[model samples]
Target: MKNSKKLFRIMTMCLMIVMMMSVTVFAEGEATEYVPKLYSTAWALVPPVVAITLALITKEVYSSLFVGIAVGGIFYGGGNFERTITHVLNDGLIGVLSDPYNVGILIFLVILGAMVSLMNRAGGSAAFGRWAGQHIKTRVGAQITTIILGCLIFIDDYFNCLTVGSVMRPITDKHNVSRAKLAYLIDSTAAPICIIAPISSWAAAVTGFVPGEDGLSVFVQAIPFNFYALFTILMMLGLVLLKVDYGPMKLHEDNAKKGDIFTTGARPYAYNEDDGKKENTKGHVLDLLIPIFSLIVFCVIGMIYTGGFFSGESIVTAFSNADASVGLALGSFFALVVTILLYVLRKALTFKECMDCIPEGFKSMVPAIMILTFAWALKAMTDSLGAAPFVEGIMKGNAEALMNFLPAVIFLVGCFLAFATGTSWGTFGILIPIVVGVFSNDHQMMIIAISACMAGAVCGDHCSPISDTTIMASAGSQSDHVNHVSTQIPYAATVAVISCITYIIAGFTKSAAISLGFGLIAVLGTLAFIRSREKANGTYIE
Candidate 1:
């Protein structure tokens, strides 16, 4: 640990010196409107690569992400100290924070955090856990119920992550399911489910990206060919039923069975040790249920309202044009108000106690909020460096030659881009248009390729540590962020591999049924094989 810290410090100092020297050399000239020398080149991807690699290697996220941002600043400013500092702060951090959408998300997170705190303090969470324990008698039952809830809340991935995590965390804890596993379940169902759900924000984002076509019709047609999203769900069920886990996740699970839900010492958002002792006796299941249900209903209504539902747009059109950040912020605010009123009316807590939760809730979410800000700043750096164009050039340059193999190729590209930038919607924006243009005449192939793009984006988002959904999952489950990322990767990777192969099959066969059928069998077959190996090793859970 000391060695790693020293190395990190040394690396940071060296980068600073390089920037200072560059400043001395370039200080003589008057600054002009600056464009990065590395814009739209392969080098644009270096910052995220640096950040992600360091994060995985160091098991420390904040410093790693800062280094990545600094690298981006260096690249953007050509090593000039003043330019690098200004760009990193002005364009990277402040720029992203200044955006209304990002602010809305931050607000939503804080409000949701407050709501979760309220639920905990009022004893709604404990009451629900007690209620669920009566009906869900096993670890398996607890996990399956979590999955079912995750799948049901598919309006938006962000909403799904926090809502599922807040609701299911208590139940999972009661049954000895690891926080890492709960996070994985919450994350796996989030984007994967949202990408395939037609009424979701993801579906809206994808549809808006396509031009000169009926976007919704195209999205609906592409659904069956979305191998990654479809197969992720299948894989989750197979793992749950087969009672098998492998790689880092298995260790976490084994530890959980032994009463250590967190295999590592790091527990970033753990509740207070005395929290259970403080539970109010007046709290009931209704306290939790009513708040969650209202959140869902209001969020849906809030989303459509932003899309102009009140102004006469149809529900489908409203959803397809909704602003998730704004809608979620609005909905969550109302939900928080309603929750406060409910608590006060029921005498679950005094109004002052409810008021105190506001700050407590914000404190709980601080870690997640900080990570998101850095992630967004990193993305901003990538954007300024023109990562999108770099990717666009690659897709356009290679599209025709890879014809029948294009969907598979597109999937891989989507994965790499989204993984690097940690933004699935951005990946969709860059790759979908290229696919549309390339396969425009062949409507069937266009649909398949688009599905591949969406699938790959979600797959990458699922695995990337810097991804907001992934970060949210960690926060929701109160697991160490790095631990969540490390454990979830193997499971996501397995599904990704199968999805890649399925996309290849879809390209040649042009039949969703055939390709999807093959993918399902492959998933089950692989899980069965894994179960056999675990049994042979005497490590099978069941």
Candidate 2:
């Protein structure tokens, strides 16, 4: 097949590159703390670039990610076969899996998956869907509700993605909304909203990256200048209210109207098909409401508790210092316990049935976990190759020459770095400090640049196929991963381009109101233009 030939050729090229590098490594004896010759260079980015390109081209994730990891191992090991194997297995995969924070997130995902399964098995999802069908009459209402819920769960993006997806999937399905659209809604809102929300884990991460100044204060001041996050919100609302869907999203939306929610003909979560058949008829709306309410309450408590709220810290201070990984894991665990008890006590499901859902829940999250693990390992490879320093060096080297245009520059660099690394947080850690150091004397510009860094990072993360948030969104919505990525790129890129322009304006004008106002107008205008085009083409949904 043509596809097979292409893949074979790509693999051959990769092997050739590795062999060539092996010859080079043999010439230089390895040291204990062996650093790759390509470390802290532009070549450090090649691994992720390969992975992302291959994923987009092949529409396959696992193999593409493995190839990326292999490339990174080759680079890091300097193509020494044994070294590459050990680095890939020992220092890459095992390293990430052994991380406590990552373990916590995995545990949280499993528990949440279990809880969703329990909800479905108990017919909580069905009851809620039936109730929602009576009230939410239109597709627009369903989407708007999904957005509102996503925004409300701003404490953490991970929690936001899964929680909102679990709660709204049924409602959105009832209104014939495509899973891809639902994934987009969830992905767009998760990081974009959290990056702007002062109390969120994202804000905390952003603040921690700034060492010299008042981090929280700067974060608050930068909120208005975060054009991508702000404009993404506007774009979502505009797209929903105006009923505008373009690019691959339009195709998915069109197909969804014909009763096919997944246009790609791939059911990644096909195991969920039997959920309706097994639903407990006695399940009521409260079955869903009670578990979700408990989750939100406990998650907040768990987050603040980690931040020392119980040890006399203020709510704001606690939020600013919370460990989201530990918090979400702890919170989800207790919530799971409560949900199981509630189900058993109400006789909605027997104890054996509740126990059965645990592994099923874990099974549901396997795809997400695998993708996340590969992503983290790939990130580890990049880290070992010093991708952060490479980007940091470039930003620092160009900081002075482009002072006036630095915000725009920073935005683009942030976008590229985040897109390559598939991590907005890592991008923030790399670029924010550079912006702070460059504009230390110019407080106003400093704020704008920092905001631009965040906006760009989110934009890139939104677009990157390897991004964990994007992966989580796909998992949360039960949409095919590749379908979600392919459908959402046009939408995210549209906002990203507008945000870049807004950052440029902010860099010169130094006025949040003016820049944001221009951005809002630009977003609406672009959406309107797109809507008109779709309508003219006879592709617009009524």
Residue 194 shift from truth in candidate 2, angstroms: 0.5
Q: List the residue pairs that clash in candidate 1.
A: none
Q: Candidate 1 lDDT, tens digit per residue, 1-542?
A: 77777777788898778777777645336578667889999999999999998888778998899899989998998867777888899999999899999999999999999998898899999999889979999988998999999999999999999999999988898888999999999999999999989999998999999988899999999999999998999999888888889999999999999999999988878654346676776689999999999899999999999999999999999999899999999999999999999999999989999999899889889989999999999999999999999889888887999999999999999999999999999999999999989998999999999999999999899999899999999988889999999999999999999999998999999999999889999999999999999888888976
Worst 10 residues of 2 by lDDT: 21-30
Per-prediction CA RMSD (Å): 1.4, 1.9
**Which regions of candidate 1 are displaced past 4 Å?**
1-6, 25-32, 271-274
Candidate 2 lands at a TM-score of 0.97
What is the overall TM-score of model 1 with all chains considered together? 0.98
Candidate 2 Cα lDDT to native = 0.91
lDDT of 2 by residue, 412-478 (tens): 9999999999999999999988888899899999999999899889999999999999999999999
lDDT of 2 at 448: 90
Cα TM-score per model: 0.98, 0.97
The parts of candidate 2 lying over 4 Å away from their true place are 8-32
